[model samples]
Target chain A: MGMKCIGIDVGGTTVKVGLFETDGTLLDKWEVKSRKEEDGKYILPDVAASIREKLAGLGLDLKKDIVGAGLGVPGPVMPDGSVEVCVNLGWHHVNPQKELSGLLDGIPVKSGNDANVAALGEMWQGGGKGYSDIIMITLGTGVGGGVILDQKILSGRHGLGGEIGHIHVRDDEWEHCNCGGVGCLEQIASATGIAREARRKMAADSRDSMLRKFGDDVTAKDVLDAAKAGDELADEVFEVVARYLGLALGQAALIVDPEIFVIGGGVSRAGQFLVDRVFKYYDYFTPISKFKAKIGLATLGNDAGIYGAARLIL
Target chain B: MGMKCIGIDVGGTTVKVGLFETDGTLLDKWEVKSRKEEDGKYILPDVAASIREKLAGLGLDLKKDIVGAGLGVPGPVMPDGSVEVCVNLGWHHVNPQKELSGLLDGIPVKSGNDANVAALGEMWQGGGKGYSDIIMITLGTGVGGGVILDQKILSGRHGLGGEIGHIHVRDDEWEHCNCGGVGCLEQIASATGIAREARRKMAADSRDSMLRKFGDDVTAKDVLDAAKAGDELADEVFEVVARYLGLALGQAALIVDPEIFVIGGGVSRAGQFLVDRVFKYYDYFTPISKFKAKIGLATLGNDAGIYGAARLIL
Candidate 1:
């Protein structure tokens, strides 16, 4: 029998679970709507049940060949495998490792911050293959970062090593973050922040040809489309975004100095337009960096989350 | 015979050397004025002769029990053990390891960045004893930094990992650095930067300051003395200096996450006043860092350079 395990990726709205062989081939997979009704206590057992049902359909016995389980939660994990906080799940100080381990009949369960797991997943089976030092930045609703140093996830003393979103980009006039910080890199560079800045900028004056068409429904995608159509305002918006992001990347380089940076998320679809702006500004800020590192798009896409979670089992 | 080795710390104006046991116990140590007339080329032979004379006094033979030699130069060390770009010594690329090895009649020689060797020395015998993860910041004329992560010095791919002096503190307003960068933390927080900024601020307006009493000969020490005497400008200078340093340190903590920060150099003599201010601002920036690691003074002082160089032999 092949060595088998279960990998689960817990997101804000849905939970993705997959059964994997020791070599990282996905045997089977399943998904379920995350517990959106209650305070998340109602969904714990449901997640376990969904995994068991999926495994049973594949004629796999959890007690025998399924050696262990791995999970990627959407927040910081305590060293003891407990969830310290998750804004989406509204969880604080909840020990997900103990809960999952007990639910799986004492099978070993490992968990980490979601972004870190994704980077690991990318390294395991995606674009970051064979790279020992890598950084994965997910540009979703918010910016999330994972740092892999010396072939291991650098989950700082309290498992908060990969919180790239909170790094300060603007010195003074930064948007207020949910974490109570101001001018965080995420506040100006993340998709949510970009959209917010655009909306604020648009409301101040309705002069742009493209933004004027959207009226109140201005979205990040709209900005991308307008830029694709050569809208000056949309291009300027991205230029500012990329400048801030590039500066933050330069600052981060002073620390991680990783071999490569993998850019992911929904906004990254803008491709070279976004990357070019970022790289152009990155050079102006990286004066003392020693190594020549490259920035590349994440090749794994949404599968990265699932793939990274699965890699935890190995 | 027990294993023995010689360590030499070559500075612009002075040469400090020591013979030590493999375990870091100091058998003997000495210092001499360096001969800068030969463009620093003849300095290595002088160091080798001094070490041999010391060993001979102890009735020791270098060709027998002595294992090897190590050196710490005040600049970036190329991977092949050459010193590069020492502005003080006016050296571009000098092979100190090869030169010293030749002087020792074929004894193997090892070399590293001066600050890095100081940190290694601390880990081997000073305040950083027993800690594998440490960052040593020397607060002298210019701030110097050395990082030891997982028992290895984190020399970035180009041998500049611990250039803490160059970390960006102010946005982009930093004047040109001797290293050709702007806004480097060293340009604002270093003793040189602090004194320079202070003199400029004082000279802008003839205020009632002890700084005026020092005339144009003002130094960082004068500002510290005035602050000790309760001069508001001097006190404010310290606050400004500490805030910049604290912000830079908080940024460093986000990446390296060292267990302890060992601070050295002459400026560190400001003692608790500097440490207290840096700690106050450090906390403001690192609200998410779980480990509230302590910042302490470097215990080894000038000997650290020689001790750290000796450490490379082991």
Candidate 2:
């Protein structure tokens, strides 16, 4: 490879590592089991050591082979390269770039917020390939967004840019968001939001075809399956979710006006089921931005993080 | 001057023009009467001739002294510099930039949305000085916004970026907006919106001392004066307006997250009476962004458009 870099993705479950070329082509990929710790102070060193061992196993000398290392951790990374807070990982104000650089024997390291890294991944080699301005939204348990404006990841002054999940959609009715706001777009549109809404609608003595079959524990997937089978309640669930999401995206479109909105994560696996409904409601909400933009699904899957990280080296 | 440009502010009432140096220093300034017609084809040629005459009077050749001309029209400008649907100016699909350029003997002209240009003006020299990322809102009869991200003007794809006025504020129970949407930020928080709400409240029951004083005609300014005099109803109007405006700004902050929000236009002249009430309610709407950014009044007065247009030279 002309230029090589180490790409590391730290999640709550596992740590993914990849050896990638400057052009975002992955040479080899592997995952190491995360050493879960209640306290994050002890977790950073374990991650650093695991990456070093992986590089050694690949016969790649950290100091000679890699130009630098890029890490995407779950949470906000300060502009100065410190992980300010990771509620899930229980880390605060940890300088992962410095610690990782030291562990790798003075090799350079760069880090970003996880969603931002994912967006970069898409921009580099995934769904957002060849597009300079794109907005990536991951609809997992929570809705997270990453903004790439003019081909650069836009991290607001407080590292809070791309917080599309927190932007309000409803007026006075919505569940409290993880970020402590009510009526946030994420509260009614994410996977958790979709499941909660389905449960709420089903509990109101409302007659449903498929929901009545599945007793209490319902998931977003259940709604999708039922909708695919042409259940009224399941279709209604998707309509509600898409309506809120379309309104939020329309509002976001007024600000950034990205050429494309790439949807990712588990709920996005619903694919055209979710996208078609979103498009219908999108026209209803997107009066001003109708002629300006388009919406699409993210193409990259699990490896977007590594590809995006490697892209930073170029 | 290393680089100089002409800034022309075309409005329904008057035309303000200034020759500005690259450092945002005003070299010369003048104002001319405005002509509003159904199809005002003469406005551009007149403007261009006036500019040439003004430059000649100062012993400055238009071609040699000015690198380019920046025009700030009171509507959306096409990417090709043609204007579309200026409700205030009563023009539709007018190519003011091309017309002005033709009159200027083929000199290059750059144009932008009026609000966006106003923000560029502020960012270049006024209240938003030294800030690369800023959002400027003109709280006039309507609510208009200009967004600057990473030192470049964000006009979306079709020149509709800073349309902060059209974002949804309420789910229902507000006047319909011009965009055929219910509960737009403009429908509840603009001067026109405030006046309409005040009229409805006054019509409900005659308990307000301020309403009796104003009789049948109640404007946003009338409400402001009554609030200043401690009229309960007038104060209520201000409270409602401030509450909604703060909420809208907070929602906008979550998306753009600009370093500063500059408020201008006629209604914003209410000063602390407006800012204090807006800040009070802003916290309720924005929990995540409130800690990071601030909302302030626009420092540039009626000349904001001219200054904004002039700042393009800088």
Candidate 3:
């Protein structure tokens, strides 16, 4: 039997763990409850203990059979694997690598931001697979992205390099972002943003449509589904979301022209309908180039985070 | 004597060359006429001849004292040192590295986009000195920029990466950019753009001041100078330019998140007044972060291309 490594995705509620072969094949995976009290003290120790138990069940020893471990934390990860403040996890200036390595008796451990790890996973085995340089846009509750340049993650000086959600797309926006800025791409393009804009339109106009039936309880999925079902008002919201996303992506393209763009997250569930429309606007906004990048859907789903974490060491 | 290498900067009218030590010191520099005739056939040959002549005059031999050569072309460069179309030099699909290497008996040569090379030069010894990751914005006849991430130039798939100027900054702009886009950062922040805006405002409004004297010929410098000398109308124009440049740089900051930004090219001559004003708006636009990047002016001037070109091989 070949040696195996561990991959962990640490979220606010749960921690996902995976046992992966050196070549990135996931042999087994499971999730454990995340204990966030006491400044998240027990979280990492629990992760370590869980890994040890799993290895023992497989007749494996931590000394030789388990080579290393990689973690995806919901925070900004420094290049040296140190984490800097995850408000969601109540952590501050923590060295994930040192702590994990110490718990495993110097067995190497690597760490990265959850979004960045997901991107690496997509690039390695999912949508951006086979491409060395790629950009992954995860359109979940918020719009987040990660850039892989020259076959390596572009982690800049402050370790906030993949903060694509914060890129300002609207100058006329009066309201501030959750991060305290106006017209952020996230403000108009995120899942929450779509619902918010849909609600705004509903309040202003008494249009006869399906969204009006949902009133204030509409979700981004509901709007997208309504648009897919040929609802006029719902389609308008979708178009606005597509336009903002496409235009911002067009701008992002000029900055770091990758071979492909992998669209993921909850909003991406709309699939080809969303990609086709966004591609139209992306083409409209881009400079007439000899070649343009292809837009694709993320295939790995939630398992991408664990795969990418394992890749951090592999 | 320490072994040195050559750095060649190819432009439409002239080709500047320099001899640099491995430690990045400029040993000597000179220029030659750029012959764009005959589809740029004479360009590389002329460069090779010039190198031979310079080496002979210095009592040096290409096989010994000179290590290698680097070039900065006014075009996109493939990762492998192949060049795409260079309209300015009347070139189509030119492989500068192989051609120069063949001409000089395989002495080895490297190539890169002019803006990217200048960025590397600034990072090595200019305003971005002491920094490995940086973004260089050259506000000249048109705004052009290059990005350095993790100490390497972020050359995208088509070698058009770091084209920060082409990032769509305005949607209302009707006039087409040379790249066929509208409302690019180049259209507003360039030296030419500033003057063009001032001319448009002067023709439409009667609330004028010193700018009325220069009429259509007022330059970015003229506007900066007038603003410095207390001209209200010129100050208004300055505010617009600063607003656009500041806003664009702030957005770019969210992408690469470099350690520093080095402002160069013709319009950067506005000096601290320009940087200070841009910073005021950049700070206005950005969220308060624990770590923020600093902005500085490029010190290399025109020689940046050659110095940066030399750095490609180094």
Clashes of each: 2, 2, 1
lDDT of 1 by residue, B1-314 (tens): 58888788889999899889988888888986777775766678788888788888889888897889888888877668766676666666789889888888788899888888898888788888988878888888888888887766766545666778876667747478766678877887778887887887787766687788776678888888788889988888888888888776776666656777788888888887778888888777777654566787788999998888888888
TM-score winner, 1 or 3: 3
TM-scores for every predicted model:
0.88, 0.93, 0.97
Tens-place lDDT per residue, model 3, B90-169, is 99987988999999978879888999999988988788888988999999887778988766787788777888888887
Model 2 misplaced stretches (Cα beyond 4 Å):
A36-38, B1-3, B33-38, B78-99, B105-107
Worst 10 residues of 2 chain B by lDDT: B285-294
What is the Å distance of residue A109 in model 2 from its true position? 2.5
For candidate 1, chain B by itself scores a TM value of: 0.92
Q: Whose DockQ is higher: candidate 1's or candidate 2's?
A: 2
What DockQ class does candidate 2 belong to? Answer: medium
For candidate 1, the docking band is: acceptable
Instruction: Write the residue-wise lDDT of candidate 2 on B127-175 in tens digits.
Output: 8888888988888888888988767678776677888888766775655
By TM-score, the better pick of 2 and 3 is: 3
- Model 1 lDDT per residue over A142-261, tens place: 888888877677666556666787766577664578656676778887888888767777777567468777766777778877877898887777777888878766766755566777
| Top lDDT hit | 3
Model 1 ranges with Cα > 4 A deviation? A1-5, A36-48, A59-67, A80-82, A203-207, A289-291, B1-10, B31-53, B59-73, B77-111, B172-174, B289-291, B312-314
Error of 1 at A146 (Å): 1.9
